[model samples]
Target: MATTTAPTTESLSDAVRRQSMAEAHTIQAMVDYRDAEMARTALIESSLRRKIERSAIALTIGEATGMSEARIQLRLSIADRVRDKTPQVWEAFVDGIIDFSRVRDISATIEKLHREESVARLENRVVGYAADHTGTELRQWLRRFVQRVEADLAVERADAARKDRHVAVAHGDDSMSWLNAYLPSHEAAAIEARLRKEARKPADPDDDRTVAQREADLLVGWCTDSDAATSAIDANIAVTVGADVLAGATPGFAESTDGCWAVPAPWLADVVATGGTFWHRIVVDPVSDDVLAHEYVGRFAPDTLAVALQFLHGVCQAPGCMVPAERCDLDHRIPHPAGPTTGDNMGPLCRRHHNLKGHGLLHWSTSPPAELIVIELYPPTPAVEMEYVAA
Candidate 1:
């Protein structure tokens, strides 16, 4: 009590590790509690006599929890599925080795198998993997694994799913509307790629709209305005495929610059066979995965530099913003005339952030060697300072 000593390094490290394990255990316990609640909700919903009554249960749950009815229903479905078919995954969740997100992934993957034995097999294979990997990685692994295990059923399932595709619009506050589409991965990816490519076109110097705004405008124009839609459809999208894959020598996925989606080899072959247009081919060093050369494969001259930058950054360079670089304006870190239009000085910025920089509300500069952008943001009125680094 008279003289307290600082904790030893070994003791501090041990304490931190113990604390992390305790937090993980607490998270696992919370997930178990949620599963129990969801199971009870599902049991009650199942006992309801009418469909309307079941839906009302979801509505009540949503209202009480501040979640959408869709989310509540999804959780209930996962709980019922885990209780009925995939108890192994539930046990893993209960054991504190995996979290609810991984449980959801496993449940969803198992549901897609459509056979009891297949579901069991997939659950056995994926539960341990989920414990070791992030949810995103688990999903990617599951997709490839499912395709490998059920190649014969994949096409049939895809066709059935395709029949469910539809578009809808939901109104939001401030006169904004959200347009949603449930479409096949390839078609949706292609549409997004095209939209992003169109959005990257150079605009008038005075144009103040952000890349997102421009993309929304482009989508609306394409849908409702015939001329604009035709022109936009005429533009090409860049699909990155391995040379061996494109030549059918090896099977692989065709990916876009943003990496949001990957088209399966068979589907990609079909698209190419059925009047899919080719644009520019950008070859990369296979080992390094760095762009090496660009060759025009179609009549239009693609913006090679823009494509390179988009691939390198993938999203807006502005800190904390995730606008796809394909849908952003490539800005010179230094003014274009002041700084040469070179890779070292160029970066993508969405319209809003670009305008903010132009108006002197924000300032940024590129650092050499690492090619990191150091940004200092100054908010108005009370005046707040924030700094971020983008690499």
Candidate 2:
């Protein structure tokens, strides 16, 4: 029998690197394929329209590809936007510098500029930036950049966009469904913040529902139960707005707690003007971004330490979980009675993970004072421990 040589560490690393590059190339090829198909479809549709009277190109493409009309239209829109307005983005995509998702985001952001010149300007500024940032980061950067480019039109655009606001529900597999609301950014952020805050409250110690479940329940209850809906909107949302912007001296963006969303300054100013009574201002050090003071306006007073903990972690301490910490239960690494409820001992865990830790299905260890968390699933399956660095 011939002896087989084992792969060295260097060879293994090289193989992985090659595989990643291959995957990137494969993605780039797929994007090229999509663009070509879309171009062909567009040409055929144009010819058919001239030969006949009317042509449903998107529907025809959808039927041919087993895609819905909406999906076909969306894909065509992105392809056309990239091809016509931002060819550099398309070129970069084909070169494997960015993936399809980033390309789509670039296309969508460019289309939103309305003016071709504005779109061109933004595309010029963003194509290089997309290579280094993830899609989410790019979208956030686009928002701030748009404000810089079109400050005077922000309020008018917001008002126009608000007209398109509505709620949507979609079915999903496993008896789960998605509920989405397309609303003004400030209003939507406030609603999310309030739901998260309300989900943290439990009427009894034995309430076993997860925080996500509780939030869903709260939404349904608020819609159907008069008593639940009668309660005032009294949640403290952490918003970081520039002092000059808040004072109406300049135009900027107001960022939410988790940095996932931003609202134009003028739109936020309208919200503040009308609902000023419900707002509490938190002053932070401009250089260090540290909270210096909390000013309350309403009857509700949020725990400062709890807010600090939520801001510090931003998400659940559970491994591979992304549930916002504001919507999670503050868990003690050591059992609550034994472990003091101090910041050093407390970390946020969504209800399911909290139960897992409580029932010994999952185990987590923490380094005190600094509070570096390490989570491990039980049974030593692959023996992987995820470490969470405190922010």
Alpha-carbon lDDT, every model: 0.65, 0.67
Across 1-391, the per-residue lDDT of candidate 2 in tens digits comes to 9999998997875664465455445444444655565565666546755444223555655676677878766766676678678888777665656666777787767766766678878878887898778778888888766765665576567668778999899999999998889998768777777788778875577888899888888888887885555375556655676565566766666666566766665555455544322445555554476776554422222477679989999999888999999999877666533444457667789999988877777666654565466666664344334332221
lDDT of 2: 0.67
- Model 1 C-alpha lDDT per residue in residues 291-337, reported as the tens digit of each score: 76554443222367678988998898767899999898776666533
What residue runs in model 2 are displaced by over 4 Å at the alpha carbon?
1-49, 53-77, 115-117, 164-182, 220-233, 247-253, 266-391
Instruction: Report lDDT (Cα) of residue 350, candidate 1.
Output: 90
Which of the numbered candidates is closest to the native, going by highest lDDT? 2
Native-to-model Cα distance after best TM-score fit, residue 79 in candidate 2, in Å: 3.6
TM-score of each: 0.49, 0.53
